[model samples]
Target: MSLTEIRSRIAKACDAAGRDPGEVTLIAVSKMQPDHRVRAVLEEGQRVFGENRVQEAAGKWPGFREDFGAVELHIIGPLQTNKARQAMELAQAIHSLDRPKLATTLARLADEIGTCPDLFIQVNTGEEPQKAGILPSEVDSFVAEVRGLGLPLKGLMCIPPVDETPSLHFALLAKFADRNGLAGLSMGMSGDFEEAIALGATHVRVGSAIFGTRP
Candidate 1:
């Protein structure tokens, strides 16, 4: 329910997994959180945060950065092609690089700006049609395609179906990243991050637990 508690839990999870706590970056999901709550977390020494929208991040983080000095932002939501440039400017890493058009857009912008954010390919491991991610069957080819464009592909990401076992999808995502020689695994959330760390998650996005429930 608190940052320190979540961090302690992360340590326990890592200890259980034989991993250094430093290996897993905890992203405080700040989407829709009131500024006071966000500032409280920042005051408590949480610099890494996740946002689901570029426009909101643009409006919120600039002021926070001015006050906090250093903040690592991850765009962990669906990215429209038009918003790619703004997202790149705001986030240090993006966990939703799920489509080729977005990749191409990012590649073009990277060429123009000479820099790009680290990227995680979202894979729909559960094969949910409504989800925005590459199919499990299509991930290999998509990785190849994104790499071919010279975009900085860090690893893979996934959000398993709510009713399905999360670890199963996390493990599958790990396999895809391993075969491609990618290192980042942006899986896990407030509930199953320990299992994700056990299966090799490099980053776990935690919301409500850290910020409390949104109104």
Candidate 2:
């Protein structure tokens, strides 16, 4: 889909939800995409992007930022504890904060560096054994722990089981964020973002729909 089409869809979704489209932030997922394609989006006036790997983003974005000047990068994949400092340096927001060790690492890094990116706790809402995220039942205590650490806790993120209904997980994530007094819901992707918007997703990470399939 073209950027125009994608923005139109976002607007429609916001309208359906009785919201202003400006309230939803669109994060174009740029992980695994080549520099040329990223530049194309940048030329089209997209300033916010999502990247899955710290190393990949570190390699590509420094140059992009030098050229583009005003882009925002978000870390949208699982983050390793050892990379906390690097991620804080590169990303404006992080959506995959799933473990206490990583939280502790970020806390220490924040104290040392005096910078902490916006953070979203990833919840394995489907309770899948292989996925990263605190389970739904663990959210309250985990949120408390992360908050006490003084990290900038923004909201919650989740990837629902592919076989199940996504709206179920989206609603659950919204509930978790609301219960925790978090204002951001970094749920939804290309496949189910309209539903996510209706359910109150403050941010949506979209990939192939805008940039086409990754090569």
Candidate 3:
């Protein structure tokens, strides 16, 4: 689909959800994608992008960073403790602040380096063992703990169980965010973004749908 069509779809979803499309931010996920494609999208007025791996993003970013000055880059995948420093340097937002050790490391790195990416607490809405986020029941305490450290703590993020309808998970997360008074909901992907928007997803990550099938 064209960029216009993609933007329209986001707008339609936001409207159907009784939301202003201006309130939702689309982060074009560019994992496994080439820099040229990202540049094209940047030209099309996309100002935010998401990448799953720091290394992959690092490889492509140097060439594009200067040109896409206002664009924001978010790290939306599992992050390792060892890579905390580099992750902080590269992303404007880090959406998977999963564990205390990693969070502490990030805090220290940010302090030492004088730059910290906006942080989001990732919730394993599905409670899947394979996932990286904190469980739903632990979010309040986790948020409290992270907040005490002065991290930006922008909001919550989640990946629903692959088998279930996404809205159920999205609703739970939306309510959770509302209860905590957080501003952003980094939920949804190419398949169920409309449902996420219906439940108040302020940030949606779209990869294949916008960039075409990954190689």
Q: What is the C-alpha lDDT of each candidate?
A: 0.95, 0.95, 0.88
Candidate 3 Cα outliers beyond 4 Å, as residue runs: none
All-Cα superposition RMSD per candidate: 0.6, 0.6, 1.2
Off by over 4 Å in 2: none
Q: Which candidate wins on lDDT?
A: 1
Q: What is the lDDT of residue 29 in candidate 2?
A: 97
Ranking by lDDT: 1, 2, 3
- The sequence of per-residue lDDT tens digits that candidate 3 reaches over residues 154-208 is 9999999889989999999988899988999999999888888888899999998
* TM-scores vs. true structure, each candidate: 0.99, 0.99, 0.96
For residues 1-215, write the lDDT of model 1, one tens digit per residue: 99999999999999999999999999999999999999999999999999999999999999999999989999999999999999999999999999899999999999998999999999999999899999999999999999999989999999999999999999999999999999999999989988999999999999999999897
Per-candidate clashes, comma-separated: 0, 0, 0
How much does candidate 2 score in TM-score?
Answer: 0.99
lDDT for each residue of candidate 2 in 57-152, tens digit (9 for 90 to 100): 999999999998978999999899888889999999999999999999999999999989999999999999999999989999999999999899
**Candidate 2 — what's its lDDT?**
0.95
Sliding window of 10 residues with minimal summed lDDT for model 3: 62-71
Q: Give the lowest summed-lDDT range of ten residues in model 2.
A: 76-85
